[model samples]
Target: MKGNFNHFKILIVDDEEEYREVFKEILDEKGYITKAASSGEEALNILKTHSFHLVLTDLIMKGIDGIELLEKIKEEYSETEVIIITGYGTVENAVAAMKKGAFTYFIKSHDLEELTIEIEKIRKIFYLENDNEIFKNQQKNSKYMLNTNNKKFIKIINMAEKAANSNVNILILGDSGVGKEVFAKYIHSCSERKDRHFLAVNCHAFSDNLLESELFGHEKGAFTGAIEQRKGRFEAAHGGTLFLDEIGDISLSTQVKLLRTIETKKVERIGSNKTMDVDFRLISATNKDIQKSISNGEFREDLFYRISTIIIEIPPLRDRKEDLPNLIEFFLEKSKLELKKQIHTIEKKVMERLLSYDYPGNVRELKNIIERLVVLSENGIIKDIDLSKYRVDSERDTKSREEKIHNNKEVEEIQRIRSLKDIRSEAEAKYIKKALEISGNNVTEAARKLSISRRQLFNKINEYKLR
Candidate 1:
């Protein structure tokens, strides 16, 4: 797993001790770390304590046949690629093993040279992936900067940097868009594994079944459309850091599996019986209140305790308004460069209005507004009118439509009276208005914010008969 190349740990599994010894002798000459197993049961047991990069398994083994061994290996130690070895008569079984996730197969009659070539291929792939991660880490370090002037925020960042000195599980609690991922990356950048891979996955994005496959990997035919064997995020993040965003969204079943993996440093791929050893520092983030979730029986308390060995809570943008200026300045220059604009300053009044406004979407919303200004402002200085145009009105409009209808009977009647189409139209109009206001009434910018075509937004504008 370490070193540039030719450092793969390999296991050879065969019922015939003689064949196993012969394979070991040939592989030893190639400088690979080789271990031999005489039966499928022995191979399974050996895999529990040992971590191997590849396994050369024989197909006609007695007791737990090769096909069964292949399934077990793919399920548990998915990080280890399996190659099925068979005689001419068992070629059919070898093909079946491939469908079940064997990496590839070799014929017993063929020269061992063929097996050596396959091993070399796997070695090259490992080197390429490792080097790519190092390169990406270097690139991120050069371009990303965590700029903050808030004293409390600074102290928290300092704590994170100190935590990075040791291997500890980190839990980041914050509202969305508060730069949780920024802190996660900062920790990784400061850690000893800085040069290794830093991978992140949003746990809320996939369904439970899909998430299982994403975290634990799957064999070629593990499920429909699996098509080919794939490595999960955990496998990819081995010897590095893995940031699981929205960890609270994972189901209880997944929480159990995750807790086990953290405890044992091993994982079983979906539909695989083999277990793979993984070493990674976990960093998880969730916008949801985890304590509240545990009380509601939606999250596991034990898992929470396991992951929160170190907790860092980031204050919302509204609470940490003191950091606004530096953040604004950073985004201002970024927008200018991105848009190739000459805008360099905001009017004093405009700056005051911005500082007073509540950013419900936090830093992400602020950056979006800054970019809009850079692209639309005719002058180098953003004026008061520009600030007014981009301001979100939800803070100003305290009494929403639903709030005005206080009577339960009236609310029920209104809901019953309005068709789904009519209600959807009304909501769409409100959002369009809000998007238009936030984009300074620029149709193109509003369309972009709504993630719709400019022409479609224009059509809706006409349909609603909006000025």
Candidate 2:
């Protein structure tokens, strides 16, 4: 068990001096730079003076219990991992501590082997996470690909690339989580204007006037909050590709201005009559059916024709079940590297169960599921994943999703023939996709409707393979 991580820094917190000293002596014997604190306040003060890679704290104390300490630690130092120590007397509190952001928990008076092993595991994970971030950043900074190791993705990529090389205006159609933005980036990266800026805008993020000002330049004092002159996406991306994500979500008035920009390749800034030429390529995405919006009179017809010269529809993940194996492998490797866990493999049972899932949210949802497992699973292997605990197999989850879309009320009630896991997973996926559609992929808005955190939404996005 002796390894390079022997030099890792550690902190132990307990109100009992003898208990703290005992653990400190044991840890020090293992060559760790160990520190001890008698209370949460004392630990916080010590933390302010110094930093440690890991903190091991008792779950209960007189002042500022372990849960509060965990909260404070997570808030101040997001990178630092903390584990809660509990006796049989307060076992539930220890588990609650984990939810509050404690990395792991331990039962006091038991063997210290698990704790020691967990520390080494976490230290390795911390380093791996650092490396993974660098890798992801590099991928972002450099040219991005479709991340598709499959035929359909390859064909889609080819189609988008061809459209980009040509002079056709592109309208990318897909349900949310179908990697529309990734496809958009691919088109830009492969285009002749690859050297120019690629500007992407979510049409629903701002109010009509604000969205207008964002697309076209705005003069100072144009509106109450217009404090300074600003260049819009059209101007900034003059010689590049302008990506309009969720184009169908924009208001009717804003759509008129957008039509003008694409039709004339010119824009007039707000509060100014000066026309500016924008020699740029146009690419737009929409989860909604523009034809429906047009029929409903919520979208502009001429603009739809103008943007749909080349239309590419992305397939949802459920339609491409064959790619599940590769996607899982990709996410597994990604999570292992990111989480700094030697999770070299997943259990056959878990994999088989995962493959059975419909994954309504798509690739994004799958990543979140895998990330959650990587974080919460004991040891380096994810064995018996409690899908029910994760809301993956809940009647409430599936019911809410179906109610939102199919009936706008409730669908015909039927006896649930499938396992709770399958039902819940399908339900959760639907909710995410619909939320993205409703909120136009604005994380905050989606979180509001789903009643989850932006972080949780982000996590689920990756877990369920939503995108």
Candidate 3:
């Protein structure tokens, strides 16, 4: 019942002056900015001059009827939502109005409660659709990526900021889950097109035919499932930004069409002869090695050059170990908020393990791990976590690297003609010491790292006097 409706303006249109005045008065009392138009023609005139979030128009009116006005509003001001007002016996007409793009219709009645509720829902939708609100939320959640201690990443951010001022295409190269989309949005937020839409498409998520139709749109009857004409992302994102994620995964044929669209600034809907001009900033991202892909003829070299006018490469999380503490804190607070838990402390061993583990999935994996820990936490403390569940591949990779190190040492020791028993004991002791160091001398973590039980690790410690 209590809400802020000052930002949303509503126009009440009805042939009857009393109905328009009464509805406007009630809406005004509810804190909504309201305007009244006696006829649908007057409503259209007012709309041409000012913006309104929702149009409340009577179905039966002189000159232009509600349906006619609704069609005009949709064709001209597609963003505005409409609600048709009808008499008791005109429910069928209201239903028809809905199919023609009315948000919802209501019967004219003394009680205004249902109308108010519908208005509140539309206001909430508008709030979510607001680009500024979305940008603020993104800034709150992705601030960790923007503010980092890594010098190379700081340079990348700086380059992105500078690139945002220009109308150049950008290609973000990084591993999966490295916040490529976040960086793309950051660039869009800083750019001149910040107030407009920031549309993102995952090129890897769709088939070649589907992706083509998705980007270029389709006319009615263009394909078997195409029932109505639809505008594509390129057209919808006019005067804004379009982020193509996993661009390297798009088929070569799609790449050719994409390249032409970029160069011509025009898009032709599928099965349509007419082309519409579109202007939007382009930001692309991919985890694949695009240069290798191009060499292998998997990606177009020319499209690569066009999209990579300003390339920004983000390093993997493992390479930026220094920023882990801040990243952990961010995700911890975010998870706590999402999970609605009051976690106040992280045990030293848990923190150590979290800090030492190499996240192959990057920031996204770290976020998921934190959420899992929060879910499993007890007594408002995060003490124990089975990171092995999330680190299966990372553990395997670590073991492979360790084996290479052990093998290199074994070859050197064999060259020196050392006894095999002595060599084995020395290598085991050295490996144990290394794991203990990596685990920050935590016995449980060291044991886990060595793939042994705590008692076994303690026995080894005592046998070698390694404590």
Measured on C-alpha atoms, candidate 2 has an lDDT of 0.79
- Judged by TM-score, which candidate is best? 3
Question: Which candidate model has the greater TM-score, 1 or 2?
Answer: 1
* Better lDDT candidate (1, 2): 1
The TM-score values for the models, in the order shown, are 0.59, 0.57, 0.62
Task: Report model 3's TM-score to 2 decimal places.
Answer: 0.62
* lDDT at position 362, candidate 2: 73
Give the count of colliding residue pairs in each prediction. Answer: 8, 25, 0
List runs of model 1 lying over 4 Å from the truth: 1-145, 379-381, 392-467
lDDT of 1: 0.83
| Candidate 3 segments exceeding 4 Å error | 1-132, 392-467
Over 1-467, each residue of candidate 1 has an lDDT whose tens digit, in order, gives: 22234578899999888899999987887778899989899989999999999999888867998889888888888878889999998898888888899888999999989988998898778777877876575446323435666788778888898998999999999987777877898888789998788888878767799889999999888999787687999999999999999999999999999999999999888878999999999999999999999999999999999999999998788887887887787778777775778876677876776777678778767877777667668868776676666544343343553476754567776767668888778877986887788678999988866545676788789878767
Which ten-residue region of model 3 has the weakest summed lDDT? 386-395
Point out the higher-scoring one by TM-score: 2 or 3: 3
Global CA lDDT of candidate 3, please? 0.85
Cα error, residue 22 of model 2, in Å, equals: 53
